[model samples]
Target: MLPRSWVAGARRPGPTPPAARRSRLYAHLFLWVMQSWLAMFYIGAGYAKLTQKHDLLALMMTWPAQVDTELLRVIGGIETALALFIVAPLMSWSLFRSVMLVGAAGLLADAGGMVVFHTLNGDIFLAAVNCVLLLMSLIILLGRWEWRDHAQLRNATS
Candidate 1:
């Protein structure tokens, strides 16, 4: 039989094992870095879209001219909101953890749409950027997912 002290940490959580603690620390660091990078990227892009006129923006990218002014602004607002929401968990209480998932999912959808829109507009660089954002979004989404005890929670709550 296994030693009494060697039981799963989840069941007996007086203190996490050293290795588990280190691993959890590393995971949190990784997520924080990625979240910061993504939030900055979206914030900058959204700010540019929101502040600059289409004529000025068109000089930077071809699509701004074709897309409606209101539509572009709306996209910009959504991007900014998504970026804020993604980092909300870090700033808020544990009850807000689910906000990260919602934000990541929304960013993923936004990136997916950008990929299609950029590809159709023949902007290869923007499409590639969209792909990178999509990958990052996926990484954050999967990394933060509460895989452990998710099934148990559903049954326990109900």
Candidate 2:
């Protein structure tokens, strides 16, 4: 509280400009909205895969009938885990930031797999949905990537 030397070098931050503030707000809103949507989607889909009888699941989506039951359940587990971690209250920790990227990447992979599977099975609607999920995953990954830090690291290394 009484460190004059430290205080002398520190500059106070001025009020944020309106454009900057609005952009920041929009970014936060986008993240929250996307996270909520993805979490809900994954949770519902995962829960259905985990708990529903194969016949019942197949009635809703034909892909489940073609996929092995064990494999389907494994995919459901992965989806549920990714959903949970994507919205986990760990963003404040720097280490958890990387986890978000991993979760996003996992979602991207899952969606890509689904897209291919659905497309091959002639499930156009489901394939389109998976395509949307893939886009969302890409957006989340881009939004979370630390461009400045990595760029600075590369420059420093060079």
Candidate 3:
């Protein structure tokens, strides 16, 4: 047997008490808001990549002649697809995880490429931004389990 205070602290509440329930509701709402923000960011990024015809491609073409246009196009297409996958409502948790993993990898690669470009061309600001975005993507990918739980809770509430 334990002391009365210890027992009281250890006791498990049935389901959730009213106050606890309200807190959980608020937490769920916050999670939904975060999810919406993430989804919208991905959607906007994909849109920008798809719509903008930037000089990045031209710059790439000038590099090591072995780099092909087809490869660049394929990378752009993959990024857009992954962004769409992140925002898709019907995607499974496993699929979302896979997409996040791939996106993180891509972001890391982009960061490396940006660093190299900046080192060669002396563009510190762009390289720093790319590094920051890479870190954000890695953090999101690592915390995917929490996002999965949030998604599950949201689905249950709906």
Instruction: Estimate, for each residue in 65-97, the C-alpha lDDT of model 2 and write its tens digit.
Output: 888899889988999989877777455646577
Candidate 2 — what's its lDDT?
0.85
Query: Which is the winner by TM-score between candidate 2 and candidate 3?
Result: 2
Stretches of candidate 3 exceeding 4 Å from the true structure? 1-72, 88-90, 145-158
Instruction: Encode model 1's per-residue lDDT on 1-158: one tens digit a residue.
Output: 99876876656448778999999999988988998999999999999999889899988888888989998899999999999888998777486678878989999999999999999889899999999999999999999997877878988799
- Candidate 1 similarity to native, TM-score: 0.86
- Candidate 1 has an lDDT of 0.90
Q: lDDT per model, in order?
A: 0.90, 0.85, 0.57
Give the TM-score of each candidate.
Answer: 0.86, 0.86, 0.48
Give the candidate number with the greatest TM-score.
Answer: 1
Give the winner by lDDT.
1
Candidate 3 minimal-lDDT segment of 10 residues: 57-66
RMSD of 3: 8.6
